[model samples]
Target: PSSGNKAERFGTASVAVLVRHKPGRAYISPDHPIAQEGAGVVLTCSAKPPGWPVPQYRWFREIETGDIKSSVL
Candidate 1:
């Protein structure tokens, strides 16, 4: 009740984003290797979504000839 102007006829609506469980393939914790190279490993990235928006883990490192590095966690 406060459109004191003279023109107000804009409309737009859309909603249909249903994504249930999507993160279920990211593991690199103490799953195996006991580590013994530099003696400084604490890698832990897990994922197994079964509900809402709760999945955010960015950690990559594939150097040698692949090129894909971004780690600051």
Candidate 2:
């Protein structure tokens, strides 16, 4: 209407989006009952709703003192 033209409509445009998320859970392959020392084990972890910034994973082991000790797996 400001460019020497008539107005066309009385409405505007709208846009929207929605995303759904599921429960996240970690999974371990070859879930063996017992693993020996110096044994090669494959540890796998993942999560749901991995959006925007990616998720980081950290592995830990429980020691005799009942304390969690971080480790690389």
Winning model by TM-score: 2
Regions of model 2 farther than 4 Å from truth: 1-23, 30-34, 70-73
Instruction: Output the lDDT of residue 51, model 2.
Output: 45
The sequence of per-residue lDDT tens digits that candidate 1 reaches over residues 1-73 is 9878788799999999977667766777778857798797787777664345667777677889887766644
Residues 11-46 of candidate 2: C-alpha lDDT, one tens digit per residue: 788887655555366455556646679996676666
The Cα local distance difference test for each model comes to 0.72, 0.64
Work out the TM-score per prediction.
Answer: 0.29, 0.46
Worst 10 residues of 1 by lDDT: 47-56
